[model samples]
Target: MNVTSGQEWVRGQFPRLDWLPDETLFSLCSRQHLVMGNLDPATTSTAVLGLSEKFIKHDIPCGIAALEQNGFHYWGSAESILLHHTIFSVFVPFQNKIKIEDAIITIKGDRIDSLKYRLGLVSSGFGAEHPLKACPYCMREDVDAHGIAYWHLTHQYPGVLICPRHQAWLMVSTKSRRWSGRFEWSLPTKDCLIQQASSQKLWLRPAFLNLANNVIDLAVIGRVMSLESCTVAATYRKAVLQGGRSASLLDRIEPLRRFHLFESLPEDEKSTESFMNQLIRTPRRSI
Candidate 1:
């Protein structure tokens, strides 16, 4: 941050720093914002809200000052950073969960934006209020080695209830990305995790952790996988039938519903079995 006479290079004030492993755009933005001033995270968020308006391009950095300067490297590539690390990145993967689509690779910018109407993700309804989580042991290790701590993208995924490394339970801070249009710049604290870590033995409960890991794996694959097919549901039905549970998936819907994450839905949507059956009957509606 050099000065020419009394003039300062605004860009150099907050130059893009080397990114951390598995960092997300919001996390990176928050980190950069901290260098600017001691203002509230809400103000920082408002300042960077324009970052979301950007679309990927071959050149011109990421359209955001700090990110564009880095040439969009590290943690994730330029393409994956924009398409998967940002908040908007959730749309494509979530929609793909309905059905795999090869077209996801070539999805038009406008088409992606239009999903705003079909899916109400912007209002913090879909996995937004879900707390920004951190692993306590990881934080301690990072702070001990690097003298700082920050959020990891892996722990932020909704279904990732446990830390893959250390096999410790991840914990959320007091703040969350609420629908109030204000984001909080909360770094991991000592109390960020539960006092007792029940997930420390995840390896022993192979079945439970394996299922969660599978979902996380799909989350990673969904990023690069084409959006042209749907196999998860069919495979689930096959497994049920093979186990002599029931030929019709409906027969086991009650058991499946117990594990499904429907807490984010409205009370009316609490009926997972009914919704699953509806999607089955009118499969085209899913598209």
Candidate 2:
């Protein structure tokens, strides 16, 4: 029940604001909060969080419920954008190797929803610290077209450091809170840009740029959830073979030279080895 002006205590039902295309659930929820008039983001979020089931960690459960009520399709918002899109795409080598459908089931299954276990919660390698990224061009374009800037579905994914359309490096906003605590949904603005990026090395490689775009394609347009892990691994092997960057050959290459041969990219341009150290473990099934 949203306490804002006694706006009907409809359990499991949420009010729908005019949601922006590719808007994050966080951003949409934030907008909903603001519409209640004069409510600060924190207070508004707390109000919405009150509607969710106890086990739901992030605001996603209620956020999805609200969006679902509003007639937005379920898969793109919840599974593709808000959930494990980052790890499934860029962070994992050979995206084709992932059993995306099974992975989706595992994440959204009753086991997780029931609060029975926290199996994939900490994607330490992929989810460590991707700064809140936005392309300035995309923001300006949104303001021009939609009249309000909102987080893009593509921009929110962790490994995506470039805007697929703009081809410019996405600027990292210096937000008030870190990733875990950042429930304050914000749209990109000129004010949010880090002035240091112009002088600093924040750019991404073309290969990575293409890969990020491909990941988004897989996420939004393609039906990749049906892929099997063996198929995924096989695809990876093919790429490696075609690349001719066998492990034995890679050993003789220099550090910078070896990078191209390896399918893995550092989580960010400035990522340290220790930060990207964790392995993508194989899924365990119940007996």
Candidate 3:
């Protein structure tokens, strides 16, 4: 965690540091490392955020304020960085205002562990286990256009198996959290693509494709609107209760078969069934 000194070369408006559209802050620092010929990830981290690369995060990055202050103002303010470059926008519609504000403050102040608990992600049953993913087509195109492959924020999430623009499957990175050097700078490249992951073959399933589309849609909508949970729940309940059938019948309908989806279902897959039942049973509340 050595702090780099005498970095006057990166002091102001570094035109060489090209911040690509939808590029993760981690990718920006990684690109800067290549552009500046930094000897190691730690040196790049020190130059970009004045912090340690040990704390470098991809999904929801911390030290945003530091990045903004460290001659990267052209990328915009911390708030803009959170909205545009990080995965913060995807959680906007699902989380409350106070939690959102706390996340922003924590991200700016370098509380990486606390940010998860603050956002209710500790019990959300998502995130941590998912690998960083990238669409191969996007990577190839990025290399052709920008001369380097970078990570995209959209493809790096739980349940986001498909690429929105290309409608192609996303490949999980082998050098993800499961790897020993997870915190080290990594970009989307063929050498790091994990082809043996279970979900690698899930692109053939219609249900998964549907889920991916919905996830992408929510991500896009969440950027501009804060959807109410009650409203969303009520709408889902209404759809389930359509045709004058009790919501209990939802369990009897084989979702995979009905939609001609997944090859196998987990024996203990009660979460969705229970959620829909509860949603239908609960009285609608004013939003």
Candidate 4:
């Protein structure tokens, strides 16, 4: 493939790639130099000299020499050139992870001839924020305080009430002393509250008398649980008593939606909903 053909295919897959500036491509290619170690330091340094010879052989030295001096490397093999050009083509922002099988290159006499390589969408992990720890639910290293608190589902003892926390969820395990679950309080919903409490810093306040009271409650309760779920249920009960919206069967849809990926379906059409919907709507206790 040529540069034109590669660009056309990339633009077709992702419309956003069409607007990237030339400097972005250069930056991507520079970063990928470490990945493709085929060209050693000696070969890299001699690239300009090689290009100069080619220019002289073609009887075009004046402009070609200036271009060669401006960091252009001449590859004797088409494969090497195609490898470099492929890196350049896929350097679009927010797109990474090009598959090697998708690339196109020409070869002649055990050397790479002129070729164009198609670039794929870049990997999403390229510019993502790194977390200090892993999330228990997703088991991903991308967990943050805000992400854990706001995005995760909270389950109660009776399995009737489910909610997402606007603040941190305290996981109390029957066999554990210290809390062994993740916490996120930096999400948009609790950001203002956390800011006001700690002057914009991550803070934890030790409960003195309340800690004793919570221990007493847990001892009498006989079940390990999430504090946030209890709080949400209590709040919901009060709202319902005051003429709020009654919890409907539709509220179960979210959990059902979550399990959809496990549903058994035709091989070609297997998806999240097919498996989960069946499980959620059926009563396992009766079975």
Model 2 CA deviation exceeding 4 Å by range: 1-6, 9-16, 46-63, 66-124, 176-183, 195-205, 221-226, 247-287
Which candidate gets the maximum TM-score versus the true structure? 3
Q: Candidate 1: how large is its RMSD?
A: 7.4
Please give, for residues 169-220, the per-residue lDDT of candidate 3 as tens digits.
7787777665656366777889878653454453344555666777767777
The lDDT for every candidate, in the order shown, is 0.49, 0.48, 0.69, 0.25
> Number of clashes in model 1?
8
Of 2 and 3, the candidate ranking higher by lDDT: 3
Which of the predicted structures, 1 or 3, would earn the higher TM-score when compared with the native?
3
The TM-scores, one per candidate, come to: 0.62, 0.60, 0.81, 0.13
- The per-prediction CA RMSD against the true structure, in angstroms, equals 7.4, 7.6, 4.9, 23.8
Which portions of model 4 show Cα errors greater than 4 Å?
1-118, 122-287
Q: In model 4, how large is the Cα lDDT of residue 153?
A: 16
- What are the per-residue Cα lDDT tens digits for candidate 2 across 220-278? 53434334445554665565567544343333222323232222534332342222122
- CA shift at 44, candidate 2, in angstroms? 1.9
